[model samples]
Target: MDSKLNRSVIDISICSRSISDQNSSETGKESHEKKFLDKNFTTKRHLKSRHIQLIAIGGSIGTGLFVTIATGLIKGGAAGLLIATVFWTCVMLLLTSAVGEMVVQYPAPSPFVEMAGRCIDEAVECAAGWNFFLMEALYIPFEITAVSSIIDFWRDDYSAAIPISIIIALYTAINVFNVKYFGESEFWLSIGKLILCVGLLFFTLITMCGGNPAHDAFGFRYFKIDPFGSGYVTTGGLGKFEGWLGALFQANFFVVGPEYISMIANEAHYPVRKNLSTCFKTVIWRLCLFYIGGALSVGILIAYNNPTLVAANTAGESSAAASPYVIAMENLNIKVLPDIVNAIILLSALSAGNSYFFCSSRQLYSLSKRGFAPAFFQICTSSGVPIFCILVVIAFACLSFMELGTGGSLTALTYITSICTKSQMLNYLYMGVTYIAFYHACKAQGIDKSTYAYRSWFQPYSAYIVTFFLLVLCGVQGYTVFLPGWWSVEDFIFYYIMIFVNVAIYIFWKVIKRTPFRKSSEVDLVSGLKEIEEYEYEHFKIAEEAQINSDTDSEDYKKKNAKEIFNNVKTWIF
Candidate 1:
């Protein structure tokens, strides 16, 4: 092993020297400018602070929280689900802090994937980029399928094909326009979802307090009935453990992709720091209000033994009926509210699908920028849309039509959901590991953490903790397959294929490229800093000049007040 490792090191050293010598032919200033231009080629900076702030909320709260937590409730029970959610929320918060620190310092199209190259190895970056790209691509269909399922809650008479096609077309058009359009659409959609979530929380509290016509105060009724769930696949301590695992997996799915915000940071307008800080802050609140609070409310409102939940769980469906909000309303004979909740679920699904298309296209564009994909994907229109990448990603929307085939949308959704969960788990594990590498690299390079734009508390310790748990969770997320009489070949493959694909990609690239992980001291943290520093300096300079101009121009006083009024309104809405 040591001999092979040494050989790998020598190979990478030789490759690095070859590349360095090739670049030595260029003038230093020319090389620096070319590197900066090349890194940002084709992508435009059109996303404003408001776009990013709202994206942070829109990206994290999705159909999983709105619809799929029912599966967690059925499998993990109320207490187990809540505990798992809180635990994973803490884990996600740590991850957000770690990733946020890196992104604020060096915002890139695919922030974590790019960081993986610098912090780990080029091979890992290649693997991580493609892995993330595929994950996002597959998620497109998953969200679209979610839309179909939610529609099913209303009327099973119409085929899903019509709505799926319409949704694909609508979001595809939105994405093809420009980043601003996508961001604005997501912002409003997210606001709608947030309002719905808040409304549901209030309604749950009221129903629990006997606000319904049935006058049945359901406060703690479900919790008292069944706290740990109907036993995972059996009836004992092992089942309770399994239930906890199920809840952990559900929570994982709910908040898997907050890193999407960092990815958008690359295209955001200047003042990335403020946007990132606001994004992280809002993410914390969203998780608390939407995920943890929603989970608790669901547990209190609906028993795990509810037939609707059992049917939804058995079918692996994410429909409105499966939603605790809808189920709770149904218990109170509140017919009108269920339809409203269903509409909200539909909006949540559509919003998530929109984001999936946006994220997947950007991931492909990032891969192209990094040389992991064909350069053609790097092509952009005058409007700064990655037209080719968008086209390629939208092409995958055709997979949504597979729902019309054997086993139907539910089967496809189950399969896609399983793949997406595992793929995202791999991404999270990579993030944790990358942060550790970054933390150590900072020390090795004599860079002070105190100087970081967004320093996360707990340093390398948080990285270690998050990384450890991610590893354990990923390893055991599919333990249900091993339960007696529960083994199924399809189930095992759906759950583990992403892990296998991730490993295969990494090993394939490592062997073909002979890429060796860099030593902590050798990691290049300075390459992108020059451009970022220049941008930051120029941004603040412009802001200062604007302030001075505003102060000096007496005639502009009314204009400034008017602008301030508009700004206040914008702040309130966003």
Candidate 2:
């Protein structure tokens, strides 16, 4: 092995819950011990399984799938459905496996960037860190852009600046309260979204069962009419494949955030290995329950070519007729409820924004801890919140409102959000490579199997398979770039900018500051979780033992039957 690699490998073994020794005055946080982290720097583990599950569900239900999938359906048709599903399935598998490997092995904050530091070059680590920050930071603007677009439901004229300011204020306030506050907020947000989805599903079923008030119980007939009469609306034809492919691709991107499961590594009460194992197993179910159910319901109830799904009607790029569910209700002559459904969609968007803000702040904190970022980011508030980082994230999100004046609101949002999405994929790619290296290092060091909290079901093969999928998706994006006006050069501008910007920053800092990438030994894995698992097991074990003993026999039983109780006591003690 190279001398540098040797140093990193050795560092990994001796790594502890301490930051790089710096003057306490520099960080502005309290002193840190070698074992537990500084109290000023610790985050609260307040998130529960409900918080995690709903966040996952919230991730799956985004505007991308709720509104944007119609565009993909327009482009690819029924065939597009299969393509989008397959592509996303592969993406999800790759992300889950790679993230699963890291969280299981390290279970720390900012696992993506840290893994980049380990598996690839350090330059890549810095790149991944900022890339992730940029992705989340930019999301603030993209989401605000949607808020403005949705406002068009009532007003023809809209101003982006006002809503942008309001969103920033809202995000900052919600995040600064405490981590649990954020969790509770997301829980309610997910509930609103789920109710909307279930309501839509019910409307679709009512329509399908031949109960339309206006259109003669149309059943599957309007699906053929093309409400707009632009032609080519049915799902069965060969010519509609491209339309579906486009919609499917968009759906794949929309459903990209479910891996938010990994973010809870520090807070989840149970072992990460156990929690993540349960999470990964639930991944397929999440996909089916949210995306499959939501999409199929929309497609069956509303025609693909519904004039409302078209971009022209909404004054933005194609959306599923605002809330396509509302359009279907209107088509069926159901009044007094479309407005309510629209309100629910608005809340869902906010919920997703809330999720993005939380994850982005945590990512910032994690990056700072590794010396990949400045120590200012390491400062946490009394409630274990990263106040400085939270402010910075809200600032970036506000900047994303620049798209409001543009004509293509949805397209603009899509363009910016796509960059963030692709950046996420880039992080996943590096994660796969990192896990491969981590796996080999463990083997080479002859580390015992017991050390790993959770092992990926299939080892090197699964890793390689996920890697191949990532490469293909990356290539597909590149190929899409050269296809004339069919693809937007501007949509991808952020992708290149993010990569170039990160590289420049890394090279400048590395050369001047003399900060070189360390070997695996230098990496710190135990610091993030701070031995929460050990604490839980040690403190909880005795209670568990007593509970088991008490469940079988009590003090009254012992007093009532001395001989029998004495025999039982002897057996228990022995």
Best model number under TM-score: 1
Number of the top-ranking candidate, with lDDT as the measure: 1
Clashing pairs in 1: none
Query: For each candidate, what is the lDDT?
Result: 0.81, 0.63
Each candidate's root-mean-square deviation in Å? 7.9, 9.1
lDDT minimum window of 10 residues, candidate 2: 226-235
Lowest summed lDDT window (length 10), candidate 1:
32-41
Encode model 1's per-residue lDDT on 52-124: one tens digit a residue.
Answer: 8767777777888877888888888999889988888889888888888888888878888898999899988
Off by over 4 Å in 1: 1-41, 408-413, 551-574
How far off is model 2, as Cα RMSD?
9.1
